[model samples]
Target: MPLLRNALTCSLLALVSHIATAAEAPAPVQSLRPLLTTLNERLNIGDLVALTKWDSGKPIQDSPREAQVIASARTLAGEHKLDPEDVAQLIAAQMEANKLVQYGLLAQWQAAGHAPDTPRPDLAKQIRPQLDELQNRLLRQYADVAPYRRDPNCPVWLAKARQGLTHDALHDLALTRATGELCIRAAGV
Candidate 1:
């Protein structure tokens, strides 16, 4: 009975230690969550952009603006010590995702014959400034999580972090598109 009790106590201690170790294990996914959150915020802005376009009859595809954004991202990437091309790709993915949301929402509104009755901010004055601010925040966040981009579990972390951010399929798709460039697997892997 004494020997059996000692064995059980040892097993319990080992189990507790294992659990603690696992709990303390680094969570790269959690570390990347702030960047995901900022990205989601950027995506959500697409709804407002859609509304502005719907009201003003402005087209969704703004080539010059997209180019400017990519340029800004490239410049900011240098400041953040991130690769310029990689940052450009990331920003481009984000723009594509935003356009996806805008296109989807515009289509729905067009089919319904009217857009949602919401206050529309001026795209040039208000919206662009807001986006610029978000761009800076996003670049900073991207810098912080840049190291985790090459982690093997990056996709898993991204998917898990993205959960519950959007309920609808369109936004979900946009989120997926936005995060497309986040994880980069090494060559031959």
Candidate 2:
């Protein structure tokens, strides 16, 4: 029951810290308009305003596994006392990973010179380390902000508790999400 006990304690601590932090000095939230607009233009997707939900756990494609993943994320967030900042960090990490993948794809495409829209195999090979690095960053930042203590090597998810995170980082988070989305769309993922 150590894991469960630890999770409960972390959750309570996060909630308390958030309340105390708010009472002492309110944190500022940033606007992501430009980032959204950029995402729409780059991805040729729907209006940024239309996509209000920031939960990455939402079904990207309908599947039981996706639903379970989303639920698991929610449970972990509840148990571990994650906050919106944690979620932003997670998205930001994902965005970075997406960029590396895109770059790898571009490199492969250029090497081939087959076409402007050709696919490449290097993307799969290169994205793993980038994702790993992002995961590490998320864990470090989470440990810094939240009440929970994360294992140095443990991989933690960040997209669950993404609310009330109002800071300059929001811009970066949006850009990262947009970039990742663009990369995925470009790569047809």
Candidate 3:
């Protein structure tokens, strides 16, 4: 009876430890808010300064339409009798640019292949979901602070791109541009 009791105690202890370990494990990082926030802030400062310099007297609603942004800023300055608000437009444009870049990359990736446009049933099934999740996070982060820059279609493009990148491809992109110079030098080209 004593031996049986000891065995039962050991089994319970083992079970408890297993459960504790499982419960205590840390979760993965899913959001890119921190990353996007930094970029958004930098873009904002640049735009606002430029806009303020072109001071047009009109309200923000009367934004100028010009081929170039600076030209638009100048036009806005002339129309509104005040400079464009650089910080405000900068934030808006940065967000827009990021979404555009993400979407373009995603479209390029999707066109490359990997089970076109289907969501994964399970997180562990493939890294594509993780990539989608990261893109979503970055987009969400951009939206939270700079809502005006939001683009719904950006995710679609991001999802496609994320799925397309294999580890080797990632490594190559990271190194290729820098290495291209070396290759040219070695070849005397």
Candidate 4:
């Protein structure tokens, strides 16, 4: 019966290993937090954008650049088999949040006597590349949530989802904009 005992022991070890792996894996909520955090991080870029624009005397509201970004985002969505509108909405909200931060920072800088102590990052070279990486991540995040977005309980689920976040994170308008468009409730459902 030694062979039988060894087989059973190997089976138990395999089962334990699988269970441990599953336990260590992130929950669905954990998966979603990154998406929200990415939105927040995207908003973080606004300071750089604002600083660059301020030094160069560029306007905060660049309609043409925003339009181009939206168009490119939608195209990326199509390639990823996601809804373009969903992608566009998220991008638009993100842009809105970004501008909010930009405007706030610019106003603060204006009130101050000089530029920030740290030298500003270059918009095209340093900042846009950061945005590009975040965009790719955001697209992957969109894919992960596409199924849940259609669920009837999306609004409720989203509302519940916020409870998992910290107050400071929630205070960031990026989280608001990111999750708001995702929580679209069906009427008369």
Candidate 5:
């Protein structure tokens, strides 16, 4: 009886160990934080953009500029073996979230007679070029993590990943919504 009990205990321990290993190995979402950090950095450009647009009286939604960005993103995605259409959708989500921040701030500034708390950034020189560079970095980060797009738990993991980065309540909600949309594209959920 004692020998049989020892054998059973060993077998149960081995089974539990195997199960834990498998569970730990396949969680693809574990690698998503760096990618999410890149995204958080990208979205943060929106505040400076809003300030610039506020100073210049530029509208938040520039369809032509947006289209140009979309085209460029698709080309970049192709270079990284990411699906162009999916990449476009992802970029659109980011852009729309960016615009939401921009428009909201711009509206608030307008209401306050253009005296925004955020200092105006140079749109033509400093801001635009910085945004272009950040776009490239963001695209590269997306490519690195693109393989895990099929993970069913992507949305949940992504939400968890951005917890620290999403500082502003409104902007954080917009970022979450945008990322949720991207996850939907990835998993068709």
Candidate 6:
């Protein structure tokens, strides 16, 4: 009987210790939420971009624009004290995600024979500025969570942090693309 009680006490103490450790563990999900939010916002703008392209009969793949954006991101990364290559990758992921959304929406509209009758914002005059502002916010938030990029659970945290931010399957996929560069596995891990 004494042995049974001693074993039970040990088990209970072990469980309590595990619970405490889990409770104190760093929450990478929370830290990454702001960056995800900004990315989602950027993804949402893909709708506007799609609408503009649909009406103008413009192609979605704009190489010059992509190059410009990447250059700007690298410059901004320097200001943020982050790796320029990494930031460029992140920004490129965002653009790819945005393009995914644009492609999806354009396809839908093409099949329907008409685009949605929504107010169209000027891509250069209005939308670009909004995106530029988001870029700044995204870099700031990225700086905050940059340390967590090496966390083993970053992908898990990113998956959790993305919940409820997307409106449809396309956006979900876009979000997935946007976060592709967010977490890098550590060396030999």
Which number leads on lDDT?
6
TM-score of 6: 0.85
Residue pairs with colliding backbones in model 2 are 29-166
- Quote the lDDT for 10 in model 1: 100
lDDT of 4 at 12: 100
Q: TM-score for each prediction? A: 0.85, 0.25, 0.20, 0.74, 0.77, 0.85
lDDT of 1 by residue, 1-189 (tens): 999999999999999999999798657777778888888899999999999999889899999999999999999998899899988998999999999999999999989999999999999999999899999999998888887888888888889989988869999999999999899898998
Worst 10-residue lDDT window for candidate 4 reads 164-173
Candidate 5: residue pairs that collide? none
Model 1 misplacement above 4 A: 1-26
Model 3 lDDT tens row, 25-135: 521112222533344333223233223222322222223421243343334443333324533353345434433333334445447753234332332244324333443
Where is model 5 poorest over a 10-residue stretch in terms of lDDT?
180-189
Residues 60-102 of candidate 5: C-alpha lDDT, one tens digit per residue? 8899988998999889987778788988988898888888888
Provide C-alpha RMSD values for all models, in order: 6.1, 17.2, 19.8, 6.9, 5.1, 5.8
Give lDDT per model, in order: 0.91, 0.36, 0.36, 0.77, 0.76, 0.93
Off by over 4 Å in 4: 1-27, 150-171
Model 6 steric clash pairs: none
- lDDT score at residue 167, model 3, on the 0-100 scale: 34
User: How would you encode candidate 6's per-residue C-alpha lDDT over 72-138 as one tens digit per residue?
Assistant: 9999998889999989888999999999999999989889999999999999999999999999999
- Give RMSD (Å) of candidate 4 vs. truth: 6.9
